[model samples]
Target: MKPWLLLGRAQPPGGGAELLLYQRDSEFSLKADNQELMNSRVYGSEEAMARLGCQNLGKRPGARVLIGGLGMGYSVRTALDTLGEDARVVVAELVPEVAEWNRGVLAELAGRPLDDRRTELHETDVAELIMAARGDYDAILLDVDNGAEAMVREGNNWLYSLPGLTAAHGALRRGGVLAVWSAVPQPAFVKRLRRAGFGVDEVKVRAHGRSSRKGGAHHVVWVAKRG
Candidate 1:
């Protein structure tokens, strides 16, 4: 068996913990506080998050999307592939080193999504972008932390709160979608999404890609639409 090599380490701005990057041959992993946050080998849910969030976008030439996390860049790449040529994808990654890793050692894992002309990188908190916008994005996808539980930072809980959900609601255009990826199901958060005036749907996806015949762990993707 191959050993995982430590590639790089980064500290999230304002987060108490450090994020570690590791590689084993072609596979990669991003972890925080010893907890695996994302892995190169398991990205089916991440891809599904973007696909479900942007399903309504189709080939819309002017569609604009915002991705909250840049883990391995799978969500952004999937979104770029789903949207039209003129579509714009704004990626907000709180950790600078995560973005740097995507450009360096981890670039090929997700096909160098940052190099894509349509992507606009923001080395800031996704909450700031969500709160500052008004009907700006056609879809907002969040893959931050460990879902509503806030594994990396306690402040991340705000992203799942009523106020944060309201901000996200206002950030989206009419009929826009907000998709959130979580390692586990969050039933209470689903109620909050409805309370924030979004029509919500909870989707369960396999951890491995759809092409995988072998079954594996399941993840949750909450698709909430702003009506």
Candidate 2:
């Protein structure tokens, strides 16, 4: 049972708490625990598909979106590729080191997404971006935590709470969509969106990257429309 060692941290784009990176070596024989998702880069494979399912919606011209995380920029890159030329994407990433790692080791890990022109990385918590949006976005995608059901950080609870959902509702324009990427099905969160005055749809998308195959993690995407 090797122990996981802390590698480092860095400042993100919009300015917020730093991203934490760690590695567990069997040599030390220490278990990583429940924090496995945060400590390791799970941006590839099924998670990438789960997080990027929003792109299935045909590109909307003049569409403006806010992305809640920037793990390896897979979601951001996918969005840029799917959206029309008139679209703009603002990424709210909580850790600067994560962003830097995306540009550094993680870039080589998942291919560089920060280099994309359509993305404006904000190295800040997605909560701040949600609070300040003010009907400015056509779509809001949240990938923070493991989903609303499982939180990686204690502070992230604020983002999935009632106030946080209300804030997300206010950020969207009429007929705008608030899309959430979850690792598992959370029917309660879907109900919460309806309570917040959104027309909700719990879409189960493919977990594998660009594939519609079976036998992979289900990407439970909560699609809610404002107004």
Counted clashes in each candidate structure: 0, 14
Give candidate 2 regions above 4 Å deviation.
1-34, 38-59, 210-213
Candidate 2 TM-score, C-alpha based: 0.78
Name the lDDT of candidate 2: 0.67
Per-residue lDDT for 73-169 in model 2, tens only?
6677777766777677898877666676678665654356577677789978788889988999878888766678534456677777778888999
Q: Estimated TM-score per prediction?
A: 0.97, 0.78
Per TM-score, the best of the predicted structures is: 1
Deviation of model 2 at 138, angstroms: 0.8
